[model samples]
Target: MKVAVHPDRRPSHEAEVIAFSYHRLALDLARHLGRDVNNWYCYAVWASKAVSENLDLSPGSCFLGDVAARLNVPVWLRRPFRRVFLALLGPSYPLALALANRAIFLEMGSLAAELWDADDDYLIRVDETGDFVRRPEFLSALLAPAEEEFLDAVVRLFTKARNATGPERAEFVLGANIALVAYEQQRAQRLLELVLNRPPRWLLQGSWRWLWCALRRRPFHRLAIYTAPHAELAWPARKAERWWVRFYTSRLMVMRTPVGRIQLGRPLPPPKGAAPETVWAPIQDLEVRELVDRFLPSDFDRATAGVGNWLSFDDRMRFIVAYFRMYANVPELFDPPFTSDKLDELEAEMDEGHVPEPYQEWLQKENARRAAAGRGVRGLIARQRYRSPFRSDPDAAALAGFDLTGCVHRRTLRPEAGPEALLCCGIDGELCGDAGGRCGRQA
Candidate 1:
């Protein structure tokens, strides 16, 4: 049999479809049991204040708007007047609209009241707290002892409807599933299985499992692991882990290497064997070249021409990290041509900061230049102890094993050295300090 196609289902549409299905099922059950059931109510309890504020009054607002639009006024005048009136009234406009369209508003309000009323007989409250009480005291008080049989019949009928083959079956099952959400979960599962002959595939899907775990108050880590293998390595999972680590472990250390960055439990002890005297390592020229090549030609020229000296340490660090991360993740996004001239220009810019200039004067000049070029002026300037000389001709073979140590060293690299220098440290202990020569203090 050919089934009618549905409109593309947005979140709201899915909700509405489920609600309509549940209402129909409730009506069918009432008719089957020879009892009068006026309305079915579905209440979604929100733990978040923000979510409650966004959703609770949405339907009422829509109802009010529909009522206002049907007010016999011409469409052109009506829309303009409505906007002006709403603008003037601010938060109180909904109340004013309800009052103006009392008849229609009241009718809509009555329907809403039936669905939202705590005293309604066929109420289903989904607890955000995850306590799916199958039969709350208030609900128990409303039903006679014998009426429990009617509820059983309702569940069985819903199960049958859920199992039937049709386009509507999925929607029917969804609605039935929600209605039975508060049921003793095991009993609901068995009844559904008896009718459908198998567990619903949706119940085992990732999104559904996530929702189920969330409702059951599972910890985020547990939820993450439950949903995906090696989820701890996933970005959001790592972020969640980091948040807890930051809260509990005050001394976590982050180390950057040639291969990848690593988070350590604590700072490493000093090298046991003979280590290199120079603590800081020189940044690979290839990395610097890559950064220059990644930049737009105009940006490359501007940055190379001492414009980088104008950028604050933080801005420089941010720009560098952003560039590298983008390059690593989506290299296709960048398509800039590399030129020897631009590299030479960058090398020229690096000459100005060989000897540290007066911090305030350098900042003033940078800010003035930025403002002259229609860019925002820098507010704060950080003092720099040393700056690296940029190499115009970077050796590709020499940089084959280049490792960007950490952000501390990257912040000190000369602008002409390119953005990648943000990851490398000086080898002469100029940046990190000498062994037993205040290296720990410098870090």
Candidate 2:
């Protein structure tokens, strides 16, 4: 029988083709992702902030305009010119790349020379141990030959392109390149695992996951070895046994003694008629994973905003809390319920010693009515007493990750208490210690 060609079956046959399109879309996309890094206008905001901090220069109230004018080079020319500017200012490009590691900022030393279009002979000084490799040369040598070549080529291309653009353009292009490189590196690693170990069918559909697979050299196993009780052990079987399992077989075999397997605990007798359960369910549901994926990025963004880097411990905790909040809707995940009216009412209530006689009598009568009916009056009265979002001491203690016993003194103490007296209870240590430093200290 003659068969018709299905559009989806042919990998080479694209759904739509561009006319006179000589360029490969992948290459063009990669180039575009790299080139748009440093937008000059964005750099000006940073440069403006940098100049504003310089009180000694005293640009005055018009300092922003002066900084803009002083640094206003075309985007294309900005790269090479900024190199000269920074060199003249005494802070080199390497210095800036060594400090910044976020989406917006990069450290001086961590910056690649390709970023500046400087001579390839440029060297970064390294000390003993070599644990922290800063220079592109060192990194290039350490990475796989293909990766090193690709990276160096990219650096060379950007450096060459730098001369064609202004200082502002150079910075923006470099910024775009930096973001793209970080993103691609992440993608390549993820894709490599995916190809090598065959992930679940569902993961391949997502835009982000597909991007990862495109960049990675191998696919990884989606389900873990510890997925549920008995799911037939999702593995490539023999190949995995030789490649990844043999290294630790001796320890695993130790549990397989003559008496009984460590986990067997005397095998149950097989039933003559009963059939084994067939359907398998994953321990972690797809919904939980989706929720976690959605919430975790926002938490990371929040942490990055509060602190310089997203790798800090507090930032990790913030991400964990955000994940758990989506995992299970718990009140402790949120801040004290804050309402403007409740705050105003609390302030008003504090101003007066007692409610009007009529109001007080009515409250007493209601409390008596509730008590006479055998329904609790205390809870009802307490509910009416506080404003919405007004957290009790217990709730506040839970939110701050402290036991009620540890915060007994805080309950008795008023907000007006002196800092010294308040901290005398050692709640400083109990509370996440100077919010910014807490994560750093843990790290």
Candidate 3:
């Protein structure tokens, strides 16, 4: 008999949110334990599966329960539960949610390892069994006794890759990271050496350069390399190098006039035509705009104009933080319109000080717009009508799009691909608020 392999199914939105909350908990655990673990993606997948298997509750439901438990609110509360809960927690919801979610994950302990080891197909199979009759047998086989040693080896390999420098260094680092998680240290090391000795045929293509750039610019780039080969370079020298790379990578725009690049502190004049409908649904509301304007400086436009047309990454983050800080107590302003995952991502970026400026600007605008419309902020990306490349169904085609890549739905999944094709698949789907069956994959 031929074993069938199905494409990995997308988790429901509630699963994504729960997974996200769990992921934050995992990150905290990793940091507190001083362990170098796999990325948030891995933790999230594990968390999603665990929640699905144990609770048989959607992520959203679990999140609400978690929140209620934290607030000492009864789960039996009905109708105005959310309203009353928000009123009780006020602006402290974010912090409270974080604590509650952390407590929930802490209850999992070593079982999280089993969830991480089990693949999606296996998890799905177990779930379909209803009572999870096959769980113990499958988990035993899935999680090897040597798993702890394997994790240690992975950290070691990453450390070694950090110190090693070659054309294939990045590839080796990525390969090693993946292999380590899969408990294949020898294969990971061989991959590193293979890249060092000979360039892969695919690397000859133009795509390799783009991949290299992406790898080098990643936030964790420095962590992958053990030693800085060019440690002697001064800060100014490093800054200049970064600027040149950015300039080379930036999309070039040709202008006829000899006008210099817009200086910091000057606002670009609004385009001549009607301002494109605000990208955010909330921004289009006159009332929200009025409210946002009130919080800003009297000469906000003029003062900000002096700063430049685009806000610096730090400034954009500051503005977002300021907005939330001011509106935290107002659920009408803070709660409904935004999803927990988006808010988590926003907070994460703020903590890391690497808020992607373009995405942040979109968030700020959308929050202001939502407030104006008497709606709470919902998700990181605003919902927009777009066609999913994966499905031909009219309804799926018209599903609201999320800006996962910060470029919106300029990309999508194909039928042959798995859920991994889309980085923001889980969170985006949840925030879109589509019912599970509505976005279900058609075989």
Candidate 4:
């Protein structure tokens, strides 16, 4: 006779069930602590899993509980792994992992009371059964025999992962993990920009088969493809290159590059519900502590020492990868049907002092127009075409569209900010009888 398992009992990956399990234990803590449910780390855990496309472990919230119960794994088994992971990943994994860890721990505690002894330490066994699940007589006893060694292995694995692929791929993976766990909007936005601006180098070159493999089945890989490579360059360098390209395009008018200035959109403050003050997540700090302890092989506190504070390995690699991606994507922005042969022909023609037909026509037209206006042709050609936006350049093309004269005073700061300030500030000032304090501008 075949064993028949209930449909729900067969291990479901349904979002609702996973969410329920994650929120059940996680939200309970918030309630007991008189905290908001949304502020719990589990929310990030669930969100991270949802965003990941290549996770081998079930995205189910109860999966952690199952991993603990079936494998006799200790709740703290992940502690060492977390540090190594974060060290390799940099500051991005903590927020996601913390929430994930919380859910896992809650489920572990619920699954087996013996998992954690009265000493607030998890038990472990070397023989897989975890039969040696006993509290230490002394409070100072280390959790397990291989605890130290295992943490070392984690760091090694991260190193291996970095070596297997370039730093670009590793950063992408780590960034994706961090975004899942990030609590603050600023942090999330920063990660998102990094992910969007720079993709791993693996996605850009190598055999088509290899590129295909890297780009598929992973959320980070997918994002890498979307952002392309050249856009990943540092803002300043990329902006310079784009300005040159735009100037060339305007003169030649042969190629239409999508390469434009990095126009920063209007500043959007975090929403009221997304305030970081209320959502004081502590995963990043914990990961930092773990990494300093595990990798540095010294007694210095990572939190106090600030090991990953200024330009960690991952941080530096991230900018490099992003800028590389930006450079890599540059050639693709030109009109398609462009080939190496065509580029060669163009270069040869330039060397032979032969301007392209279109460019010649444009030059002639510009010369005639200048002559009619009584301006010398030599003067126009001698003018410097490129100008940096960072510096004060009067000749720089308008950053935005034409300015509206009628809306001059209102747009002193920003057009969008003006209306909102007028309405909200006006009402608040009137209600409190505080005219000077109301609105951004004086009433």
| Per-residue lDDT of candidate 3, residues 356-434 (tens digit) | 2211112223324544544234323333322121122221111112111221111111223322222222231122234
Best by TM-score: 4
Ranking by TM-score: 4, 3, 2, 1
Each candidate's lDDT (Cα)?
0.26, 0.25, 0.28, 0.27
Residue-level lDDT tens digits of model 2 in 213-285: 4468334221222111122434444344234322222121111111222211121212233222210111132
Off by over 4 Å in 2: 1-146, 166-443
lDDT of 1 by residue, 291-384 (tens): 2333313232232222121112222222332222222212111111113574354334323332211111122233234334552332222222
Instruction: Kindly list the per-residue Cα lDDT of model 4 for residues 40-95, writing each as its tens digit.
Output: 23433233333221112332324334324444556667555434422332211221
TM-score for each candidate, following the candidate numbering? 0.17, 0.17, 0.19, 0.22
RMSD of 2: 32.8
Q: Give the TM-score of candidate 1.
A: 0.17
Error of 2 at 209 (Å): 30
Instruction: Give the lowest summed-lDDT range of ten residues in model 2.
Output: 13-22
How many clashes (backbone N, Cα, C below 3 Å) per candidate?
5, 46, 23, 15
